[model samples]
Target: MNERFNKLRQYNTSGLGCWVSLIIFALIVGKIGLGGVVSGFLILIALFFLVPVIGFWGFQWWLKQKITQAQCPVCEYEFTGLKNTEFNCPSCGESLRVEGDRFTRMTPPGTIDVDAVEVSVQRIEEEN
Candidate 1:
C-alpha cells in the first residue's frame, strides 16, 4: 500500500510547481530588496510549491485506500504495472486479461494461444 502511494506521488510532479516557485522567486527578488526577499519571496515560493506536494500525497493516499488490487489473471500470480498489451504471466507465462480494477483469467494452464488472452491496461486516476 505504501509502495503504491509513493509511486503515485513520485510521478505526480509535473514541472508546474517548479515554474511557479521560480516565478515567485523572481518577483520577490525584483520587487523587494534583499532584506525582505528571504522573508517575503521565500515564503511565497515555499507555499506555492507545497500545494502540489500536498495534493499529490493526498491523491495517492486515496488510490491506495479505495482502488481494487488484483494479480495476474491467467496465472493467479501477483504483479503490478504491465506496460505492454502482450506480456507473459510471471508465474505461468500464459497471456492474462487486465480490465479496469480486476484481472480475469482468459486461458487455462499449458495453453500458449496468442489470440486467446487479452491484456488491457487501465489508466490510474488521481482522487480530487
Candidate 2:
C-alpha cells in the first residue's frame, strides 16, 4: 500500500542519504529556532560531513566510468577489468582484449609448446 518502497533494490539512489540528512537538519533548526548554538553546530556538521560525502560519490561515479564488466568471447566468462586492456580469462586461460563493451579473443605472445621433456639422471633420481 506504501509507494515509498515499491521498488525492489538493495540500496537507495546516490546522495539520497545526504539529502535526507539536510532535511532532518532543517527540521531540527526549525524546532530549536535559528541563530543558536544548536543550529551553528548542525551547520558545522553539514559542512564537514556532507561536503565529503558528495565528493566521494562523485569519485565513485568516475571510477564506474573507467572500469566495467568484460566477458570472454571464447569461454563467455565474465570478469571485472579496466576498459581497453588485455587480460587472460580466469576460467579458460584464453587471452582476451576488452574495448568498451566488446570482448575480442587475442593471441598470447611468446608462448611455445614443448615436444618432449628432457630430464637429467640426478633430476629423475630426485623425483623418485
Off by over 4 Å in 1: 1-39, 48-52, 55-68, 82-86, 105-128
Clashes of each: 0, 0
Q: Give candidate 2 regions above 4 Å deviation.
A: 1-44, 108-128
Which ten residues in a row are the worst by lDDT in model 1?
Answer: 80-89
Could you give candidate 2's per-residue lDDT for residues 70-128 as a string of tens digits?
Answer: 67776687888777787788999887777877777775578654457787766435553
Q: Write the per-residue lDDT of candidate 1 for residues 72-128, one digit (tens) a residue.
A: 754567775433244556787765555676665566679674647678999999999
Structural similarity to truth (TM-score) of each candidate: 0.36, 0.45
Q: How many backbone clashes does candidate 2 have?
A: 0
Evaluated against the true structure, the overall lDDT of model 2 is 0.78
Q: After superposition, how far is residue 87 of candidate 2 from its true place, in Å?
A: 1.7
